[model samples]
Target: MRLRHIAYALLMATALAGCNDTIDGAIDVSKVKNKVEQPLPGRIVAEMQKKNMPRNSPIMIRVFKEEGKMEIWKAKADNRFDKIADYDICAWSGKLGPKVKEGDRQAPEGFYNLTPAHLNPNSKYYLAINTGFPNRYDAVNGRSGSNLMIHGACSSSGCYSMTDAQILEIYAFARDAFRGGQSSVQLQAFPFRMTAENMARHRNSENFEFWKMLKAGYDNFEVTKRPPEVNVCEKKYVFNQQAQGSGQFSAAAACPPMSTPPALTAALASYEKEYQVAYAKAMDKLDGKLWYEPTEAERKAIVAEKRKGRDLAYAPTGTSLAAGKLVEPEEFEKLMAARLAKQTAKPGQILTASTQASAAKQGRVVLPGTAPGNRSTMSVQTAMAAPAPGAAAPTASQTARPQPDMAQATTTGSVPVPAPNPLAYAAVQQPTETEGKKPFWKFW
Candidate 1:
């Protein structure tokens, strides 16, 4: 009976062991179902420069807000950029302005870098690009809050957004950066390319002079091999700040003297003043920047005004206004067509008279009475020349060509003649049929 008990106990223990195994198997299947996959690291390793990327080289990324573009470059031998890839980007939660703080929904402008600690695989946005770069200046001056990431698609609360495919490629690039010996990556985001033409167009307001300084710093770095120094403590942007010298060397040349006239400067200022406000408002909308969410009525009014103005300025109207004042659309088109026809007409050709005689009244020389045998209807100089003393003026070509009607000639010092239609002349004067009927044709 004791032996029977022992055998029965052993059988029970074996069954319990099997039950444990079954439970473990079920858990394994559950884990597989919930698993998140990451692409193999360094799939695009061949594109990187082997020498410059030690076991861990630092990478650099630049995002241009206005262009909606991003560029990735690896440090290369001779201390230059070897472009790895470029990606289209969607940025920020808010419009074109620099992000001031958390939940402002604005994307921060200026430079930041990536750090290993910030990488998150389980990010709500899928994959996240580590931004370890701290703007030492920003941190020191307390400009912006931290943890900026360039991550996967899911509209940015403040990060740069890329589609899943793009993030995969980026992940591989980052993997290569780590394998090559990059400690961290640098990211610089800017509102736009700080070009002189662009700045002059948008930076008209007194408030925007600050932007000019920032643009200068960006431009200086573009030419020099260094990141600009932040003199933010001094409340100014510093130019040509040095990075750690990699034994590269150069000296900047002296700048040339300015030759722009004061008048030209004033003219440009005037132009900017006239157009910048409307342009800025349009750009703000395009960038999704508005202080308060506009009501439909307000939005419609602004949009209509912009559309009307833009259409008037650019569309091919049949008529034009003498001044930049508003005119009825149809009338403007007619006026433009008339003006163009007037400009294209032969010097002596007469046009139908109209009350709007501003150009002629302003001492514009007018064509006068036609002279006999003259190819042009009138000699333009006759409008200015005094009548010759006691000289019987030669009759006009119209008088010569048509039957002399003394009454008409005496009243206006000119006579009207029926002019041949040019198109009719072209049709009648085409190469005669006889010209095509050569003797060779007859032989054939």
Candidate 2:
């Protein structure tokens, strides 16, 4: 009788965790409309069997903000997790940073968990899974936000958003995991892949120390290929460890001395050693330059380029900063002027944006969720790439569902039209350097 009561309590807790949204009451998920629930797709079911994952196994999720991907890892027969699928994030608000407070419009970054209560089948934007932001770590660190979610709609305010179809599939994964008796699913969110090279690039970011802490847990999972047990103490995250004494872990209080198994420590140390070497190489290559968003003049140039139909939809790499800080300011201006001169010298360039603007205007971007072959028709072709006057009227493209002003894009924290697309960017062939023109180098 006692065991039964305990189990019921645990189940109730699991059912009620992290649901501070508009959910009224739980509905029977079965016998629902296809919009409210869907069975695992047959293709996914077959992949699970091939990978030795159970139909309703526990799962883990990891999100990369810059990459705009969400990966699902399911438990295999051995109880170890294997990545089952990666879903494209159609939209996520904010630049690469953690949400600090309400109304910041920044998506959160850190460890969170999803429980049965987190699922909202009746969500306004198809189904949704609340992210349970301001987790213990966020709470102790003084972060504030509410109702952040992973949901359908391909839109975002301060949550990871996916296409309606993608979220339906993801919603199925969460539902099945709960049915499998998993109490909660771990959700790890990061600004980008915690690669040493990325770290070196962000070495000067205000959040470097916070990110380094996150990397510890990330490293733990990388070495073991399993989710690390996360606990917060002294307002910091401590992973895969236990207090030395009987002291309880407290998010706001100091962490008691903790201990880890020697084997785990050894593995993590080995991983870190390799990581350190990579970090050194990256730092050396970057040569102490830190990345910043485009300056005022650079953004104006981008605006001008778009007016001339330069395919700012996926602008060439270094075009982000108008080649800022890289070349001396005067030299960079000269570069920009020369490039503009070559562009306006053509008739076709002025005619493209109006034609392109009449496209379906369905918020076209080729991310993981796009049903392949939907790439923007604008691959690199040299047309007359002129610079418009700084005060030129809205481009022909602007007459359609306008791409947000680049400055508003930066201020609002949404990934802009011309932002970096790392997943497929390696295939973007770079332009060759001519005596008067520079090649595209740095990416946004």
Candidate 3:
């Protein structure tokens, strides 16, 4: 009887395993049906054919907020991902930062993933893929938020929005990957491009430490062109193993002994070595000083030089009454009176007629007007020969005055205009925390 019972137990165990396999097969079949029905499957297949990649290959996504770009990377037969496309993010809320809480209306920045359940074909925004926010790392740190997504409709509250056409293609990529047997797709979102220059520029930001931690993961894929195995330990993200043992990982507990593949280890080491060399050179070029900061004297000199260039470019150049040389007070008053009289001269009267008449009355040599063209020439000669109302004799230098600089009249300080914030859109309705009633079909 005991032997019979053991046989029954073994048979039951085998049956259960078969049932599990059957269930998984059904799920995959359903996914394949959904994917095939959409136009995306054909396009994906064509892309794979063009690249000499097999169908249902793995894929990944990377988002750069400051650049407003999302890149799709597809795994080739060699197991390394190749960039397939870049889509413009149509709209995203908030500035360059991570989403921390509900109602903050901030798009998240960090590593996240999507599963089959996260796909929403019936979404109001046309389609969406939920970003698994508040993952193990977020939970350990007590962060909270939900339903963050990359969706369509070109509008956003706290989501990355792409046009309907773009989302159609993006959604198809993820769907085909899932249908191809991928369990989950990884998505890495960043505030900006992770580079040595960007790191140095934002070194003093409050989020610098967190960003540095993220760069480890960024560099992993950057070097290997493969998605990094992600794990959270002690409330921090740890990527690509550093020690050897079972591959088990825990979110809140101390990380277990882990080891990286020898080839990956060597590659990462070489990448870091090159990065350090470049970083050092960049720092040395800056003399270890912040690029944005300048001494007061240096700033003033810069402004002065800019002002001088502007004046030279824009200042008007011409002969004018104000260009006359400095003279005795009585002589200056007489010149001003002559200019005023010439300006107010009656119609049909020559511009210098009043000045010439006054000069002739003072017993000055007044030349006769020749032809119309020569009239101006005669007037100029007559004025040059005339003396001030009550001044002494003239000197040779007094007759030839240097043109005055019109720098003050032309120089204008440029007012720096602040750029408009891209996130300043009409406020979107905040998502409610209450879970809606589940479909009756789910009860089964």
Candidate 4:
């Protein structure tokens, strides 16, 4: 029995040795030998100096897929981080969502950290850093994918691809940080800038709940300008806290008594207070209308209204005035008279206050800065017939529907037209249709 135990111990020792060798062998130092020897770029060094940041300070990377931008942030002496540089991603695959399975061609989105073990110096793509997919949160969700990378080559297949030149500079940044004793570098991947406006715009998206959770970490960083310490518990990301007793965490286990530094708690509270004020202001600016699909009834009403306007604008001759044909002959005579009067009027003859007020009461869409003679076809025929020197201005009901100003139209003799008061058109409101049915779609 003693001999058998000795043999078992020897086997376990051999297996451990083999595992270590395999891990070490996976790294190809030859591929990065030249880069490791080369000095950091002069521009980057100069930027660090200007920011008063020391060389070899810790770094964080942020990738915004929608903007196709990658930003590098480095720690300063004050314990805060500042953006050092931004690079455009040469290429990427898939759409704006997290990768779920292998062969899906989707890029993963979440907070991931990388160590030297994640680097691939011998990549076919000039240089590559494996994004450690199937992270704690992903694993708890049963997601599966592998070998996802941020690499050089200007080509992507489930990766963020950068130009060779850009990668060399990026690779150098990482190497120096690692050499300076940074055990790991955090990488925050986001779909876009997480602003209140953007969040409101995507409020009805399917992934809104997930995005809200991501925003917590995003907000933390935004307030402190430092990476939030992230951990996974109950399959959800918890920021800047740790289990009280064990001082350890498990992605699938219930979270232990967690606490945040008092200073961070205070800062986050202040940030949330300010954010709430701004968020309310932003929401108030919106008209509370979903910009997505309209109801069937609303669609039909819009179509009918457009058709009715078209018929009124081009009615046939002899139609009753009540049936939407503004006495055609009288309108024609008015247009001709306006044209003749305009040709003879003095350049300095501005419209009188009462005339302008009458036009406003008429709901005529006036192009404020346009020359008096420059008017739309309908305006010339009805609202702008250059009233004879002392003639009365027309009332609101007397004019036909307002038409677009000719001065602002895209034509040969176009000129700048002043913007109208936004509130002026607010008087016209479309009636809402009540379908009396529960919505079939669920945003959550």
Candidate 5:
């Protein structure tokens, strides 16, 4: 009965108001071409060194949906990962929840791993890294999806997409790690950062239990600064646990007796103790609070507007919007204008008439009732800059649309997406690792 209900939900998912994805066929991954990709830009390498991160060290990622941020953490001299940068997510489909079935249109929230074979060099949306969803837990729980990717398109449909400039840097990071003999990279996707306040704010969410299940992994990484060894047993995520006495794990079968590292166990106890106190106080404040839950009319109006918007084109026309969200057009243009400047400052690119014209308004998103940006686009000379070190972050917008950092003007339209096949492009030419130094992730 439970399985039947889920299948029916997937079928009605598009029609239903809460679901964002529509059921689609298996996504074909194009074969990687034998192209010699560019190396990591010199400035990025310098930035890594400034942060005490090796230029080609192993990296881990964490994605927060509500925050619309993707943080890259790299191994340092101590072998513990430290955050290197937080790149804004251009677009991610669906709301704050775990993807339950195929076509739910939800960006998955859980642990994923990517290997060299998963890199799609010749992608329709620039470079892409396949997020290997439906790991043991998803399969055991009967969820279904494919080709859910973290890619270089400023648009999404059941994927976490980013600006082309962003993906270029990101893709190089993974490529360098692989070159340094790192086998795989870990990505932890969450509905939002697992701060107690964030969890409490969404206490009424239908996916709270699942988010809590994911929180264990979130907490593990927080305390240890390492990706937990993710395992699944009895249809649940089991993180950083070693089975007692050679006990193995099977997704659908019962979990064997297991134990966590003593340090993690101790650290987690302290972390949870603090989190619980904060959560309880937050929940108390929520009691009897009068929150702004939009009416049915408002929700429909917003959904209709998104359907008409430019970036939301990849989503199904009938896809529903989540409650209590509205797009802020004015500020979006400013930030996008800034991003365009930075991406375009790439060396040796000739701009033609069409490109120059497109460059004038590259990646502009038009939402209903929102006025176009009156300010002129930043010139190549002006936009080629990053936010100053230790500067305050951008103000949080009501919603984030794909105001792309236009790395190239050609990224505007759809191109031929290649069929998934073996990529040649140097499958694994191991770069010499630092003598006697294993990647920090390998320690755990």
Candidate 6:
């Protein structure tokens, strides 16, 4: 009887244990299902509706090194950009902050521009997005020849990289930008928030002031909740002026102070001597009013020679001409021809097959990114279906969509709805300032 009672008790205890486990498992599964079934955040969904998010438009890429995040804003047909996607990136190498000088191998800070010329469709990264603008600020301060790229795969010596999955989304925007005639894309890469706390972290470094200015812009944008307008010229960036205007016309814009007249004269003299020889030869091929005073005999000769090429030998007269005199014409022509031969010329008017052949011998310039090394060839995937003309894009209302991974979407912070096809908005926000910063050069 004792043995029977013991066996019975053991069996009851085992059954209870199994029952508890079943109940716990059911509860856990229910909790997970509940979380998954919850509706998408109102902010994100609202933004999607407001921006008509994901319509084809120009793309604005912003990389925040501090946040390890890359944000993509798509331009609408109207030419305004709405926040479309955010990507996680892996720097892989380099230091933990903004790049300032050459040999740093650190990711650059400030703004860059990209065009189709910069695109690398066959890149090892599978997809590459050209930052439409390079840091004009760096080049203006004399840092040129650094290549900045966003590519697929988390492998980089010092570039912004993404996983293969993330790159697909990025490539979609880049392709649209290229086809949409916004062939060039704009990029802004920043170190951190340029926030006070972040700046204080580097309090002992000499780059504090540099950070201060960048921080000001960053803070201004963060607080105002607007991207600070960036205008770039010849690889230089400035905030106060439009990117493509004559800075002299603006009174309020902060421009590089004009150099003294002597400096201007010297520069003009150098340019005139270097360019005038070649220009004179080309212009000599045309009929034009001469800047130099011509004798009646020379003028008559010039008129007669207009149909044929001229070998007119003019001499210096005043001190200005004498002091700035060019070498004799025959000698100068020889030198200029040699220089021209050395240069990779633009498409010149050959006008004849023989001339074309001769010019061709000067050799074609291997445009960067077009070479096999740069991955120029494109991989075109055929679309499975075609849409009718002027058809509306498929939206949530039009189709059943799969839910995104909740874990992946959780990282994105508060996001505002953006206007759909904001292309016009970006086009209208014309840069208010334009000026190239002087390069850092010292006369040897």
Cα lDDT for residue 350, candidate 6: 28
Residues 328-368, candidate 2, lDDT per residue (tens digit)? Answer: 32343344334344534365554233323222121111111
So what's the TM-score on candidate 3?
A: 0.55
Question: Would you list the C-alpha lDDT of every candidate in the order shown?
Answer: 0.41, 0.59, 0.56, 0.57, 0.59, 0.41
Q: By lDDT, is 3 or 4 better?
A: 4
What are the TM-scores, per candidate, against the unseen true structure? 0.42, 0.62, 0.55, 0.57, 0.62, 0.42
User: What tens-digit string does per-residue lDDT give for candidate 3 at 177-282?
Assistant: 7767665678899877777655544442335557767777888788878777677765577776533444345566666666556676677667767766655555
> Which consecutive 10 residues in model 6 have the weakest lDDT in total?
403-412
Which stretches of candidate 1 lie above 4 Å from their native place? Answer: 1-57, 130-134, 139-147, 205-207, 225-232, 235-444
Question: Candidate 4: lDDT of 422?
Answer: 23
Clashes by residue pair, model 3: 243-258, 243-259, 244-258
lDDT by residue (1-444, candidate 5, tens digit) is 999999888867544322221233111123222222655545556678887887778899899876578898898876788887778776677656777778877788888766676788778988898877766567767787877898876677788888666777678788877777666688899877887766655543335557767787888788888777777776677777756665666666777877666666678778877876776676556442212223223334544655465564333212222444322334534443444455464677654434433553333221112234322222211211211111134223111111101000110112223233343235443343334533323455
* Model 6, span 1-444: residue lDDT tens: 999999998987685444322222221222222221222233333465677654345677777765567897765544445667786564333434455454555566665555455556567765665443224355344543244567765555456766544565566566555555563465767755543334333322234334544543443234323334444332223332222333331212344333323432354345434433543343333222111211223323333433245223211111111122123334433433443344434566323433333433332211112223321111100110111111135222122111100000000112121123323234433232135332211110
What is the Cα-based lDDT of residue 123 in candidate 1? 72
Better of 2 and 4 by lDDT: 2
Q: What is the lDDT of residue 235 in candidate 3?
A: 58
Q: Once model 6 is optimally superposed onto the true structure by TM-score, how far is the C-alpha of residue 26 displaced, in angstroms?
A: 29
lDDT of 4 by residue, 277-365 (tens): 55555544543422121221222343343345442322111101112212233343343335334534468766554444344323222
Ranking by TM-score: 5, 2, 4, 3, 1, 6
